[model samples]
Target chain A: MKADTNLSEGSGIPAEARKILTQIETDRAAYKRKLVISFIILAIAMIMVLIALKLDFRFMKNQLPFIFAGMGYTLLVSFMAISLACFLAVVGALGRLSKNPVFNSIASSYVSLIRGTPLLVQVYMWYLALPQIGKALEGYGFTGIQAFFTLPALTAGILALGVCYGAYMTETVRAGIQSIDPGQTEAANALGMTRSQTMKRIIFPQALRVIIPPVSNEFIAMIKDSSLVSLMGVWELSYRAIKMGRRHFQSLEMLITVALIYWMMCILLQYFQEKLETHMARGDRSIR
Target chain B: MMENDSPMVKITNIHKVFPQDVHVLCGIDLEVKKGETVAILGASGSGKSTLLRCINFLEEPTAGTVEVDGITIEAGENDKLRNGRIRDIRKRTGMCFQAFNLFPHMTVLENIIEGPVTVLRQKKEAATAYAEQLLQWIGLSEKSDEHPSRLSGGQQQRVAIARSLAMKPKVMLFDEPTSALDPELVGEVVEVMERLAKEGMTIVAVTHELHFARDVADRILIMDNGNWVEQGPPEKIFNNPEQERTRQFLAHIL
Candidate 1:
C-alpha cells in the first residue's frame, strides 16, 4: 500500500515539465544558430573555390550526371566493403575474445598487422602480390581454375577496403565489449546461459548503442575513400571523374562537381546516422 | 523443481591465495543449512566476500570443495562436470550486488525475466507472471517498463533484487546490499530482504548494517584477517562479543 502511493507520486505530472519545455525551446534556438553558422561556413568555403579557380556554375549542370555515374561506383564499392567489414569485424572480435591461444593470436595479429601498415601499401599488396599467390598455388599441383586466377579490379578494391576497415571495426567491437560492466556477463553466467548466449543476449545488445555511431562514421568515410579504388582501375566515381576531366580539359569543373556530390552524400548520411542513434537510444531511456 | 532431500549446499576446506604473498581466504570452512539466514561480518579485507564468492565459484578456491544442493564445484584434480551443470549451480544461487549492476539495456520487467527465459527456458507467459510477482514484492510493479537509469539508486537496487529473484534460486547471497544505497532508500530494500528472511530462504549476507544484523540474522559470524574470530546467535554476538577484535569492530561501527 505504501509503495503504491510512492509509485503514484513518481508519475503524477512532473513539476519540472515547464522547465523542461523551456530547455527544449532553448535547444531549438541553439539548433537554428548552428544551422546559420553552418550555412555561413559553406558560403565562405564556396566563395574560396570560385576565387581560386575562377569557377563557373553553368558547367555544373552539364557535368552533374557524369559525376553521379562515378558516384554510383564509389557507393557500390563502399557498401560491399562495409558489409564484408561487418562480417570480419564480428568474427574477429569473437576471435579476440576466444580463450584459445591460436585464435586470439591470429585475430590479434590481423588487427595489429592491418593497423600497423599503411592503407596504400595494403591496396598495392592485394593488387600486385596476389598473382604470386596464384602462381604458387599452381606450383602446388593445382592447375585449372586455381592456377591462373585473377582478382577483378572491383574485387581488389573491396578486399583493400574491407580488410582495412575490418581492423578498425575489431577495435570498435572490443571497446564496446570492454565498456559493458563485468557484472552483466557474471549475471548471465549465474543464469543457466552459455558463454555465446550471454554475449548474444546480454552483451551484444547493449554494445550496439556504443558501436553504431562509430561504425556509421566509418561507413561515411569509406564512401569518400572509395576513390582509392581508382588506382586499381575500378571505374568508380573518382576514376570516372579523372577520366571525364582528362577528356574535357575542364578538370576544375569535373573536380568541383565531384566535391559537391561527396558533400551531398555526406550530408544525407549524417542525417540518417543521427536518426539511427536516437532510435537506438530510445530503448534505454527512463522518461523520469 | 528442487527436492527437499537434495543437499542445498556443502563447502569444505576452501582456500585461496594471491600473488605478492597476499592471502584472500586462507582456509574457509562453513556450511549453510537450507532455509537458514546467516550473516557474515568482517572489519575490512577479512575475506568474508571472498568466502561468499567461493561458494558461488566466482572465485575458485585454491584447494577445497564446495557443493550446492547436491552439486559440487570442485573437480578431482580436473573439472569433470559438463558446462551445463556448472551453469545449473550458478542459477540455483541468486546474488544481490552492492552496486546493483542492472543491465541498462533492458526494461525492469525484461531484467527480471532475462534469467528465466534465457537460462531456465521458461515460457514468456510464465516468466512474465513470475516477474510481475517479484516486482510487486520489491514495490516496482509500475516501473516494469522503465529502464534502470530512470529509477533512483534505491529503486535500481530493488530491481536488481527482483532480477535475481526471477530465477527462483534456492539460496541467495547479499554482498552488502544496502552499502551502495543512500540512507533514505536503504529501508525499502531492507524491508524486502526482511520479508525474504521471514520466508525461511537460505541466505548468506555480508553487511555492516547493524540493525539488520541484529534483527533478522539467526547467526552472526565475525571475521578478521581471513579467519573467523567468533560466531553465535545475533543477541550474544551483538550484546556480548567474545573476541576482542569483534568488540573493537563493534565499537568502531556503533
Candidate 2:
C-alpha cells in the first residue's frame, strides 16, 4: 500500500491494478518498436507476393485447387510413413539392445547402411532394384511374382521415407533409454520386476518425453521432403504445382502460392509442436 | 516371503573387481539377521556401498557366494556369476538409492504401485490400494498423483521408501538415503528410517550420517581401505573405537 490518497485518486479500484496499468504504460515505447518491426516484415512479404503475381497473373485461380489437391497425397504418405517408422524404431531399438549377437548385428548393419547412404539413392534402389530381387525370388520357385516387384508409387515412397527415418529414430530411442538414471532400473530390479516389466512400466514412460520432440521434428522434415517422391510420378502437391505452373505460363505465381501454402502448413506444425511440448513439460514440475 | 525373524541376508567371502585392474572389494563377509538394522559406515572408497550393492546383486561380485535367508544367491568361480541366479537374489532384497531414483514420468502412486503389480502380479485395484496405504504411512497422501519432480527431495525419498516397502521385501538395503538430500531435509528421511527400524525390518544401510547410526542401528561396522576396521554395538564402535582408522573416522564425525 503506497498511500490511501494515491489509491483514492484512482477510486474504487485496487492499488495493484493501478501499479500494473502504470507499468504497461511505461513500456509503451518498447511495444511500439516491436509492432513496427512486425509490420515491416509483413509489408515486405506482401510486396514480394504482389511483384511475383504481376509478372504472370493469368488463370492463377483456375489452377489453385489443382495444386492444392496434392496436399491430401502429401499428408497420406507422411502419415503412413511415420506410422511405419514408429514401429521400426521400437523394434530396431530393442534389437540393438538385445543380448543375441545375431539380432544386434543385423540391427546395427541396417541402421548403419540406412544412415550412411543418401535417401535419394535408397529411393532409387527400392524402386529400381526391387524388380531384380523379385526376379531372383521367382527363380527360387516363386512364379509370376513380377507383380510383387511392381510396387505402387505411394508404397515405394512410404517404404523409403519410413526406412530412412527409422534408422535415425532408433538412435533417438536408444539415447532416451540411456538418459534415464541407472538407479531407476536397479530399483525396479530390486522390486522383482522382470526386464520387460522394468522397461514397459518404469523406463519407457520417462524416455518418451525425451523422444517425442525429435521424432516430431523428423516428421516435420519428412513433410517437406515428401516432395522428392514426385520424381516417381506420385502426383503430390509439389508435382501438381509445377505442372500447372508450366501449363499456364505462370510458374512464378503458381510457385509462390505453393511456397506460401507450405509456409502456412509449417507454421501450423510449429504451433502443434509447441502445444505438445507444453503438455509434456507440464508433467515435470521442476520447471515451476 | 521369508520369515521376519530369520537371518534375512548372508554374505560369504565376496570379492569384486572391475576390468580396469582396480580391486574394489576384497574378501568381504557379513550377515544380517531379520528384525535388525545394521549400518555400514566407511570412509570414501571404503567399499561400504559396494557391499550393500553386492547383497542385492546389483554389482556382480567377482567371486564367492551370497545367500538370502539361507538360500545361495550368487555363485561364480572368479568372475561375474550367471545373470539368472543373480537376478533371483535381487528379488529377495529391496534397495533404496541415495538419489531416491523415483521414476520421473510416473506419479508417486504409480511408482509405489509398480512393484506390487509387476512382482506380485496383483490386480491394479489391489496394487493401487496397497500403494495408497503405503503412501499414507509415508505422509505423502496429498501428493499421490504428483510426479517426483514436483515433490520435495525429502518427500520423494519417502515415496521411494514406500515404493520399496510395497513389495513386502524380506530385506531392505539403503545406500546413504540422506546423503543426497539438502542438509535441512536429512532429518525427515532419517526419521522415516527410524520408524522402519522400530517396526523390526531387517535393513542394511551405508551412510555417513552418524546420528542415524547412533540412534537406530543395532551394530555399526566401520570400514577403512576396503576392510572392516571395527564392528560392534554403536556404543562401543562410536564411543570406544578400537582401531586407529575407526578412531580417526569417529574423530572426523563426532
Q: Per-residue lDDT tens digits of candidate 2, residues B1-254?
A: 45655567878888878789678778888878888999999887888888888886778788867888666754454435455555666656778898888887778898888877877778999999888888888888999988788888999899999988888877789999998899999998988889999998888999988788998999998876667788999899877888988888888878
Model 1 CA deviation exceeding 4 Å by range: A1-45, A48-52, A145-149, A280-288, B1-7, B80-82
- iRMSD for every model: 2.8, 2.8
Every model's DockQ, to 2 decimals?
Answer: 0.41, 0.53
**Residue A83 displacement (Å), model 1:** 1.1
TM per candidate comes to 0.90, 0.90
Candidate 1, residue A167: how far the Cα is off, in Å: 0.5
Residues A1-288, candidate 1, lDDT per residue (tens digit)? 353354456665465764565577688899999999999999999789787877766766777776677767788899999999989998899889889999999999999999999988888888878878888888887776443456777888898999999999999998898888897887777666788888999999888788999999999999988889899987777777778888878788778778778889999999999999888777546422
lDDT over C-alpha atoms for residue B243 of model 1: 87
Quality class of the docking in candidate 2, CAPRI style: medium
